[model samples]
Target: MKFKLIATFLLFATCVTAFSQEKQAQKSEKGLIKISIMYPFAEGKTFNMEYYETKHMPMVAGYLGSNLVKYTIEKGLAAGMPNQALPYMAIGTFYVKSLSDYQSAIAPNRDAIRADFANYTNVSPVILVSEVVK
Candidate 1:
């Protein structure tokens, strides 16, 4: 009975690990990662849109080169429902061709990129990486 339990546990662990690896493989094979950088608003705090759009993004261009295929910027005006405040002050989507390209482009300039954040907004940004299926 003890041996059977140990075998079952091992099998479960192996399956879990395999599933996680499969997902990782799929993400890499897709060859596209959407890097989302978003800043949420706080009362009395302002988003320095001028600096972000004009300065920060341009600086990023120096590091990415051709790896960054495209990008989009969004300004939060209002929420869908009345009396609801906008969740984010702004959002920037960076479309990376591949995971390796994203890593190579970002690794060297990570510090400089993060340091520039203070120039634009007080709120710390949230970053999310995802691959699009559709």
Candidate 2:
């Protein structure tokens, strides 16, 4: 009976240690901060994809400096429903090391960035900050 009890306790301890290590590994594998800009589609709105890709994004990247890991711009194609309009016209995403770092880098450039909107689309962008977990 005592031998059985000892084996059971050892098994429990091993399981506990393995679970802890797995959790730690998952946490370490999580990715950096992701800042997403989603521009909802609306009628009578115009977007200059050329200017956005060629000029505005590069200027923004320059402002982000070392804080920015990478950035991507996605143009809206078609909606999931056939013949349905797209939910968003464009999406721009920025991967950064930290949320605070991104905020600090963008703070001073806010006005300048907003002012440059005239060079691109008139759509109001929705912003989302998230921790990438993949």
Candidate 3:
């Protein structure tokens, strides 16, 4: 009985490892890449609401290797108060075939975006890369 139990446990462990490997393989095959862009609103300056909503979004869409999956702009909960931080922000998520593809898409247009927002004060975008694991 003990031997049988040990054998069963071993089989279960092996199957679990195999299943994990299969899932990893499937994710690799899909070649999905995720990028997040976070922007914090600058103090005493009006955020470029119109340009972001219209121009920036459309420009991102026009990139060859990536697709804009999600875009969100939210007011900072900590808005104006004494010693309080700024209160407006935006976040954008982009999806692409691979990390290399995403890099390639943005490299050529990097200067364009910077120049477009040159007049804007306190415009900062944080970018994050991610892979879906399920």
Candidate 4:
């Protein structure tokens, strides 16, 4: 009887926890947009990784506020083979929860952001956006 009762209680607790988590997810904001920018690599062209990672991104975070959910930066090491030239210099990914919020917050600062590109790299960044499915 004791074993059966403990098993029943454990099952009930597990179900309740799962139900709670599902409800929480449902209540949270739904839209998540991912923006990826790939910067082409060029011989002798420069990218200031230190300034970008330390200064520019923090400025972006200041401007975007709650709209910017997260972001990541990746440096291109090689194209494929060990000796092959790199196809891209860097890649940046930014996640925003709402499109409207992003537009409102970032639109005004677009020129400033563009200008800062010179501080980082000579290559123009190719931008792409994607919506999270789920």
lDDT of 2 by residue, 6-78 (tens): 9999999999999999998667547888888888998998888889889988899898889787899999998
> lDDT tens digits, residues 29-117, model 1?
46567889989878976788899889998788667778776777899998889999888999988877776878888898999998998
TM-score per candidate = 0.72, 0.76, 0.56, 0.70
lDDT: which candidate is best? Answer: 2
| Candidates by lDDT, descending order | 2, 1, 4, 3
Candidate closer to the true structure by lDDT (higher is better), 3 or 4: 4
Residues 46-70 of candidate 3: C-alpha lDDT, one tens digit per residue: 5566777677766765774334443
Residue 74 local lDDT, model 4: 88
lDDT of each: 0.84, 0.88, 0.66, 0.83
How large is the C-alpha RMSD of every model relative to the true structure?
A: 13.1, 9.5, 9.7, 5.8
lDDT of 4 by residue, 1-134 (tens): 99999999999999999999997765552567877888889888889888888887778777889888888888888889878789888888778888788778889999998898888778788888888665
Alpha carbon deviation, residue 12, candidate 2 (Å): 42
User: Per model, how many backbone clashes are there?
Assistant: 0, 0, 1, 0
lDDT score of model 1? 0.84
